[model samples]
Target chain A: MTTEDTPNHRTRVAAERRGKTRAKLLESALLVFAQKGAGAVIDDVIAHAGMARGSFYNYFRTNEELLAAVADEINDELLRAIDPVVLRCDDPAERIACGTRLLLHTVRRFPLYGGFMARLPFPAANSGLLGARFLARDVRLGVATRRFADIGWRVGADMLVGVMLSAACSTAREPLSPAYPDASARAMLRALGLDEVEAARLTALPLPAFELPPSSLLRRAQLLSVGRD
Target chain B: MTTEDTPNHRTRVAAERRGKTRAKLLESALLVFAQKGAGAVIDDVIAHAGMARGSFYNYFRTNEELLAAVADEINDELLRAIDPVVLRCDDPAERIACGTRLLLHTVRRFPLYGGFMARLPFPAANSGLLGARFLARDVRLGVATRRFADIGWRVGADMLVGVMLSAACSTAREPLSPAYPDASARAMLRALGLDEVEAARLTALPLPAFELPPSSLLRRAQLLSVGRD
Candidate 1:
């Protein structure tokens, strides 16, 4: 009876270990997909994650499902990172400044995810798969637009969103040189009808350092290695 | 002696007629090229201009040279059209409004040229042969950017030029529905930091009808007939 129970306990422990492995695979997959793009093959992802090829199918039924999971993971992470900064201030200008800073920081940290986010259009029709990632930013902008409208400025949310998104996309593609963020941020504020003094004040604030994970470097190296092979 | 001098006068008159025909062909080429894009074949342009295939070579040494001429003609025409408007206003906002109104009118009149203008990038590098049609707008925006900078706004002229060029391109492509020019124009004004009340007033003004010359219509009809043949 003791020998039979020991065999069962070993089987249970193996299953638990497999579950943990799958979770780590998914996390690694998100980093890889964000860096290389959603179109990357499952084999590449499995290799990057340091997992067996057979184990990938156990967690993700297909690459499509895996991409969906990545989008969800990124969306949740971005919301958690940005929501607090957006909600920190009552003043609209302050909100914009904080939001801009938070976004820039996030982009710098997760450069690949940042590029993906900027490139993704405002999923108006296909909301099921890609919409989850865009929802937080859209909602935040919608609220900010309302606040601006309430303050007697008849600005359209889509226009503001388009401008900010374009700015962010441009910023993500290039490194933030000394002249860039200050010049670009001031231009954005001026474009939004902020006075010169207000624009200067917002532009003067130092941008924060981005905190990227080691997994990102690992994923990129994996991609380069795979391409070579 | 009178008959001998008459032949000389007649020869001179015939030469002048040939020169005028060449000039007309070049002008028509601009209209056709701007509509069809720079990549348009010589046969298409000849068909549009109601000229024989062989006649095109009489005016232009080659298709490339014709494209260069088209660019030159457009640059001259665009400058002539907008210079007055820019000179009329001292305030940057007012100047921008005047320039916008003029551009809107020009785009409406020659929708094809507007299409060509839309494709050309700002501060066009290859203005001599491949990209001359793009120079006028670049100069116009250069003046506007310098003016804005003179007022102490350190806005990057290139970025603002890109934004305005994008706006112009969109305006040219879409039909003027009730929701269009007003919404887009307002967005443009907001983006440029123009006064809201002033922009609203400008938007309220009636847009004029776009007029085309009889020869232009005749040429278009002839081209259509040839297409059916």
Candidate 2:
């Protein structure tokens, strides 16, 4: 056999195919989940991705595993969108406000991703997750600077999760106004023990443009294939 | 025929028996619901109440209907527990803090009832039920007096909802401290646009002793029946 038919070559090709299929399945699953929540099954994902049902076992063993993977990936996307803008702030309070406002903007702007996020286990309990980690970091910084009142760190994080949950659930019921994110962030800052005027002014501060990572080529190509079919 | 065997007496006795059976079923249903969450079925409830399976249809047509009735009853109990202490305060801010702290106390003190309340629809959306309405009414007063800064009523209500939800969920995970309710209430007031100092002082104010309504005779006796069975 030629070098192209060698076992190593065949294995590498198989691995690449597997990676592509997994990406396709994840993208399709997220889209279905956004529309139908986490209850949509493997069949729903397969129909959405236009894939053979037998092939799904190579990637996710169950809908729950697939959903968890989607939750993990989306949180990464959210962090990527937020970090560039928020990481620049020197003041802890500003960091908290700006970071939160960006999160709200992302949630409002791309609802499907946010909806999945709101369904995950309480964010504070799993602070290692990207969203809560950023918030906890900012809150800790605020306490160090004496900018925030010393509510316990976990309590602070939990409150922020509660606020985001409130915002996410409210937004889902109806589209949020341009001012809603600003108002929501300001409210949480107040809740975190910011002065009313400062919370209001900080919330009103102009937020910079933030963008989530561009959809991967695999995701785009697979979604395109679905569209074509 | 004997006077005791008259048609009216028989009809009255039959109605009373039906009422007692329904009450017995509801109390058993709630206890079962708390132990097993919402999934415990009519059969489970009937067996727990020591009633025939056929009797369930006479009170609740379905398990879901029974669950809704339980939710309604619990909200009423929560309101009865909270309103007297909270409604006595005239200062809107003090009123808000007291009402909510009492709610946190209620939730912390009664785990099974609290757990069921926590699982209801998003607290902000259904704020009229249970503790939220008192919180909302106080917030409205604050807004009217301009004692609170001018965030709209719903946002304030929503933020308080966020705070209470945070407290409820966290308290569920672990017992809250004696000061947890105070600190949590202060945090929400700050979030509601109060100055941090004022919020802190208000939270530290002596709260009236609050008590849940004593269990109705029906409930106590029905529970006693379960214990006997």
Candidate 3:
């Protein structure tokens, strides 16, 4: 009998199910790591996910690898959420405002993942390994930032990143604080050269789902992957 | 001699000596702490200053007190370095630029002390025993920030404080890199509705020292006494 027609096909389907279980394990790792921080142990992750001890090694080689994967996942989600808004708007001020609102919304929705990555205790960016990783990420954002700078937006990409990271960290630490979101949105708008009235108007509007032009998503994905490498 | 003359003479002489020794201990502590974080032992500070252990104790009751005093000294230097330029500039953008340039120069001059205070793992503006002591020194600088905000600068006082602290920390970590200082000054200027060219012009000028206006020194001295209380 053909293998596809045999009863053992159920076993093959079960293996596929196990693959999904492994993905679920990694997702659980991200959630737990975000909530508890990178200092969390494998056992704690497994306990939180209600998974078997033996099953972890089947998915990840070590805790470090798992943490790295978690970082990648969080980075991907962040880009997924905000990149469209950044790329869609041609006006620098409006682009920044939309991006800021989307970022605030994303942080509120996935507080743990966003917060943990924002507070990652990597070495100084000038240090070889850490710096390379940081610069890789910087290059992608620099593309958008340089676009603004070319058209009279004078702030450097580093300040933009620093301000965003600071805002994200503050929001993560005190999500329930009413003042944080308003202050953060206002700060970002001001940084982008929007007047107070305009900034407030932009901030108060509901953020719309941004649609990417043809090939934009693919290019961004490639750039993001390069950053990860 | 009369009893009144005897009392006054002894009191003045003792006060002079006490002030001299206190200044010496503070200088020593700044050097030691910068070289080896706040965790360095009291013996190290005393040895570095070539002072006797007994003399160190006579000046500071504990290491925590010594560190607090060191923080105060650094803050005072920072305030003295930037206040004149900041207060003299009527334009918000010019004020931010001048303030940033003065800060950068101070960090460059005393990289270690700047790094120690900037990256020290203490809360920003706390009210706990140590926090209260630290915040008392910070309040002077905080007032200047509020003044900037009062002049229609878009950045809030807290955000300005955060930016300043972040700039100091980044500069301390990477003094040779121009990215941080340039980005910081630009961000501050942008928040005040000024472009980078104007900000750069103001930052290029030499900064002045902070001196009390007229009789304000008496009030400052009273505030210092209140902090002690």
Candidate 4:
């Protein structure tokens, strides 16, 4: 009945608590799936989250649903972190180069995210993942602008995906040199039809500073891991 | 004992039977691991192989051992299939180009092998797997002979590995253009620092005919799956 205990305040507090519970489930699920591959089950997830089975069922019906949710959050967070940097670059080639470098660096920063990414099946070039959509647009513009040769967009996307997957997988497993991102970008640009000198120049262009956003699942996962240790 | 059941003959027959049983386990393990990821259990493999648990234990004591055995067989089979064609191309750039094309083609021709490959962890550039050893040699020779720029062999290999992994993953999932292999090779050559025209020419060179050896695990796996159908 007191002013501090109004129904509206109570409802808001309940909703906030629900949100925290759901996020805890997702963070734990990402870690479990990353370590166990596709074999991770709901029991393992609930146990990792320190939640009752019924509590987990409230948020997700099955492991696949949980996995999909985790992927969605991670993808959204990555786009948020990366799009600003990508937008700052005017040239399509520079966009691709900086995006590739930033992506590899980001994976290196969050090994858990990289681990899960390494295990996910490679989506087809036109699968319309937001990241792939961005890559496709950049590639098309590059070809149209004659900055890149007229390799089909599918082929161009495949080259970038391949390089990124390889680099990401490596980053997930171990520490790599700081130069790996630039080196990978340089190779990818050449593959996309930029001449050696041009490719080199674009990849060597000063990259903007990038960091995982505070709200990222990966950053939460990293903090959770540190907390556990 | 009767002459027909002489000790030497009995021993030879036992060894042959053991080899066949071991091969059966490997093929089934590959299929199960490919489909289920690392969560596949020994029971799943034995069920797929249609063998008793005791019989399975006779061949592989653990699932990890079985997976490793399968990997070794695949690496050996792939090397046998690829090495001759690679040797036939004397120029280091041609060697790299043709090798890339042939590998993608080989994976497409045997998707079961490709599926397992897509799941297996990507190896380090210096891991010294037989195939990696060959690639390292080609990359080093390419740099030494000035056919490729000094991008450093590890970075050079990473670009190729990334491209080949992406191409092989796609080839496993769906049918691609006959030109896909050469196109991928051309892009890879550019990544390795070949000029556009030269890269295209090397990849377009007449590729020596190649086939999976009849005795390869992939060939056997292909036959086994066909038989199941």
The candidate that achieves the highest TM-score relative to the unseen native structure: 4
After superposition, the stretches of candidate 2 with alpha carbons farther than 4 Å from their true spots are A2-67, A83-85, A113-130, A216-229, B1-70, B113-130, B216-229
B91-134 per-residue lDDT for model 4 (tens digits):
98888887887777776676676566655544421133324346
TM-score, A chain, model 4: 0.91
Candidate number with the higher TM-score (1 or 3): 3
Number of the top-ranking candidate, with lDDT as the measure: 4
> Which numbered prediction scores highest in DockQ against the true structure?
4
Candidate 2 chain A minimal-lDDT segment of 10 residues = A121-130
- Per-model TM-score on C-alpha atoms: 0.47, 0.76, 0.52, 0.84
TM-score of 4: 0.84
For candidate 1, write residues A67-121 as lDDT tens digits. 5565565545545555554565556555555555555444443345444433232
lDDT of 1 by residue, B138-191 (tens): 334534665332222223333333333343344444633334335445434444
Please state the CAPRI-style docking class of candidate 3.
incorrect
Per-residue alpha-carbon lDDT of candidate 3 for residues A61-172, written as tens digits (9 for 90 to 100): 8776776565565445556646655666565556556665555555554445344543343222112211112322433443466533321222233344444444444544
lDDT of 1 at B61: 73
Q: In candidate 3, which residue ranges exceed 4 Å CA deviation? A: A1-15, A52-54, A122-155, A176-183, A192-206, A210-229, B1-183, B192-205, B208-229
TM-score (0 to 1) for chain A, all models?
Answer: 0.61, 0.83, 0.64, 0.91
- Candidate 1 lDDT for residue A54: 81
lDDT of each: 0.49, 0.69, 0.51, 0.75
Interface RMSD of 2: 3.4
lDDT of 2 by residue, B142-217 (tens): 9989988777776677667766666665654567777677777877787777887788899888778765545642
